[model samples]
Target: MGTEARRAGRRDFAGLWASYGLSNLGDGLVVIMLPLTALTLTSSPGLVAGVRWAQTMPYVLCTLAIGVLIDRVERSRLIRWAHLARVVALVLFALALSGEVAPLVALYTVAFLLGTAELVADLGTTSVLPMMVERNRLDGANSRLESTRSSLNEFVGPPLGGFLVAVGTVFATLSTAGLYLVAAGALLLLGRRYDPRPAGESAPAAKPRIRDELTEGLRYLRGHRLLRNLALMVCVMAAAWSGWSAVLVLYAVSPGPMGLSGTTYGILLTALALGGVLGSLVAGPVRRLLGTRNLLAVDVITGVIMLATPVFTAQPWPVGAATFLGGVGSGLWNVTVVTLRQQLIPDELLGRVSSASRLIGWGGMPLGAAVAGVLAQTVGPRPVFALGAVACAALLIPFLRVIREDTIRAAVASRDTRGE
Candidate 1:
């Protein structure tokens, strides 16, 4: 029976995995296209920065509500709906771009709407994973998913998006919309029975109060020492990453800075994706070899590279190398952190807790982007990058002090024992 169950689980997981890959590729294409589209509309760094900020803003404002929704509704259905929403947004955006000039306001509005849908899809997909596989195999499953995301979204999609945008923005965006439609279609295969109600919850005994449900998720995170601290550390790291990334495209491609052409910039971006691919592949073995503590410690290498990039080199090759190394660290860090969160959180509370945690962790992204934009305009891109690296380095102190390797291992072991 156990063997049969595992086989069934693998089959289900494969469907979910494919859906994720298709959606992520579309997401990757948009990631490149959106900013470039904004640049074409306006040359103002702050205005261009708004494009990134608008996309991330939904996480801060809507994730808590979405988290509550995920807990109550069918997750697969929610994901499908979210993908459909994105398709609508993308189609509208492509229409807006069909003219000689795409309006900045339209770009911002579309970006925000797309981001709102993404928040739901991302949360649902992640929370749905444990249901598809046995708990023990979560790390491997997450690593595989992360690797796929990096490869398709980061590696293939960016270059393709750049090429498409170079040829024509409207065509690229319409193609991305088509991809989202495909992703939505893929989710239909998960079937109606995929999301069962949480354990101990009675059927439709009046709609649960939103405030109460929201509080439960927050209170759970507050009470759990590891989760609470981890969320905070993640917030800091996210801010640093966002700050650097907000200004990165302009810094790399503009004639004043690195001066690389669109295709070359896309190639440089691929170097980061390639490093992520390598990191995801090695994350498991490296974690086992180095132990959890050292594996996490290695993440600081990314901050170090960010710091060095501005001071040591302005040339594309050297900067690309730095981004590659940072991507490697990011890949390993994501697999480790995500797997740990999955192992620790209760299955029922997973959706709410994941959203709550992300609210804290990812909430800083918009703020960072806004700040970086202002700073870039004021102090220039190099200084903004330098400041971001310093912030990243400072975050390590709290990260190390709060997260103990033995505690994490013990928690996982306890969960396993309880499951048995």
Candidate 2:
């Protein structure tokens, strides 16, 4: 029965992954198209930046409630609804672009709704991970999902998106909307029908109140020294990494081998995409061989590469090298952290906990982007890149004590072993 259950889980996970990958590819296109659309409609950098602000600010403010929603409802239904919401938002975006109706406001509203929906989807997916597979396969499942995301969404998504945008905004956006609707349909038709645990196993006698659930997740996270320290480390690293990437256009525009026209910028984006593909492919083995802690240690080399890019006087190679290495580090880091969260959190509270988890980590993304803008304007583009590298290097140190070899080994073992 355990073996049969494990096989079923794998089958279900494969279907889920396919649906996610397709939708994620659409997301990749949307990221590029939306920014380009904004730039076309309004050439102001401030407005462009404001769009980013609208997208990120809500995650910090609204994720706790989203967490509650994920936990309190049937996750599969919530997942389907979130995708449906995205479908509507994307279609609205398509209409606004085609009709030029309420243009900027429509675009901003769409970005806001999509952002909110993404948080819900993210929370649901992370929370449901443990329920989707035998605990023992968590690392492998995470690695596969992360790799696909990096390879398809990061590597392939942008270039495809850029090409579609060049073809025309209306076509690109409408195509993306089509993808979202397809994903929604897939979720409805193909998702798992089995309950997380056996039937008649009774719900917990007293369902924790929403406030209590929220507090419990927070308190548990706080008391778990490993999770607490690792979360903090990730937040700092992500802040710096996000800030640097936010200003990538500025770096490319500066004099260097990396510098190029808009077309060249697309090429560089593709390069980063390819590098992410390579990273995702290798991240699992790297984690297994080095352990998560050692992987983090080795990742510091990439951080140094990123920092040193700014100090060099030469062109493209320096910047390109930094970007590639950073992408690799980020890919590995994502797989490790996401797997850790799924393993650590209990099944019922998974959604809320995962949502609360992101509230701290992803909450700072916009601030990081905003800071990059200010730093670029005030100091210089090179200084901003240098700062990001420094921040990545510093953030890893605190996490070392928590993500030791034993911790990683235990995490992997627990997730991989099927319980009878």
- Per-residue accuracy of model 2 over 1-420 as CA lDDT, tens digit each: 378777766776766777677777877776666766776787454565556667776677888888877767777677778888988888777888788798899888887887888778767766666777766677777777777777766667777887888888889888887877777676665446534334466677887787886776677677666667676765666667656655565556324335565445555565565656666667778877877787776666676676567557436666666667867876677777787778777676677666766777777777776777677666655776777777776665665656677876675466457423
Q: Which tens-of-lDDT digit does each residue in 52-112 have in candidate 1?
A: 8999999899988998988887788898899999999888877777754446888999889
Q: lDDT of each structure?
A: 0.83, 0.70
TM-score of 2: 0.88
TM-score per model over all chains:
0.96, 0.88
Off by over 4 Å in 2: 189-191, 194-207, 253-263, 307-314, 377-380, 400-403, 406-420
